[model samples]
Target: MSADILTFRPAPLSQADAARRRAMLLHPSNFVPASAPDRDATEKAEEQAGRFDALYKEFLDRGLSANGARTEVARAAAREIWDGFAVQLRQHRAAGQQMDANVLAVALASIQCLNSVLPRRPEDPHHAVRAVSTARRRLQYNGGLLHRLHPHRNPAFQDAVATLQSLEVFLTRPQQHAA
Candidate 1:
């Protein structure tokens, strides 16, 4: 037997191959098939809206003003979304698998939502602004990396970016006091 050890080196993927791989990784169909019926989608959306309306009505019944009820509902929803993301992140880490782009997008969006609902500290009004600014910078950097890797327009990613932008706007606005 020869003393030399042979190593196998795979050839670089062609552009078409790269594109196909990216599509496989980033395609929405991987989670929910693109061919899913429109009726199912509509039903799911309507169900979610109904749940929100029920919760809002419940809060109103509890004697909260409409604005207060809306704020409370937003906070609760944001908390739930953030908690779900945390669980998914933990699961992915436990499995030693790289996070899917969609997961990252959802997590970022959840963070934005949570930030928007968080009550600013009277003593440190600028704290939220600074924190959100830092987060936005980091998110933009990572988002750019994800875009480069996937080389596709992901609607989830776009929505997450938009959510972050909205959070920035929310942070800049003066706090509204309930009269």
Candidate 2:
């Protein structure tokens, strides 16, 4: 024997109910005023985000919006950072010293990219996130290799790894987007 099951499906809304719903969705302010504390918190949140968007081009030498020139500039910045790390990597190998300096550079690059390089967004929306993602990808790719080298617990090496991990966390975090 099969058991019969019945589910409560909401009936189609009446015309008056549908119109009221549309009005409610269209005019939120008509129902309630924004509270002062809520308004103040929203303002503060907005203030903290994109404070330097106007200066993204000034800092990075490219506009916030996508352009061939802007993409090139970002790639160039990553290349320069990589070149610096590469020189250090070669020096350590040639001089027969531990890979201390090169590892340090990796960590420093991660922090610098997060703090300085990526903040130069040409536009306020996803621009900063995209720029930071570029930097984060480069840093993590190299840093992953460095992590595998087993630096024998050198404090500086450990510190650099810690910093890079922290930056990765920041980049992966969910950010508040605009309404």
Off by over 4 Å in 1: 1-48, 101-106, 109-113, 121-145, 151-179
Query: How do the residues 115-155 of candidate 1 rate in per-residue lDDT, one tens digit apiece?
Result: 55345432342554455455545555555555556555434
lDDT of 2 by residue, 1-179 (tens): 22322345556789999988876754524433223335544344345333223332454454334332333333344455456555666777678776666565665565465445443553332454465455555554445555544533334433333333332333233432211
Against the true structure, candidate 2 reaches a TM-score of 0.31
Over the full model, what C-alpha lDDT does candidate 1 score relative to the true structure? 0.51
Q: Enumerate residue pairs that collide in model 2.
A: 64-122, 64-123
Tell me which residue pairs clash in candidate 1. none
lDDT by candidate, in order shown: 0.51, 0.45
All models, RMSD in angstroms? 12.1, 19.0
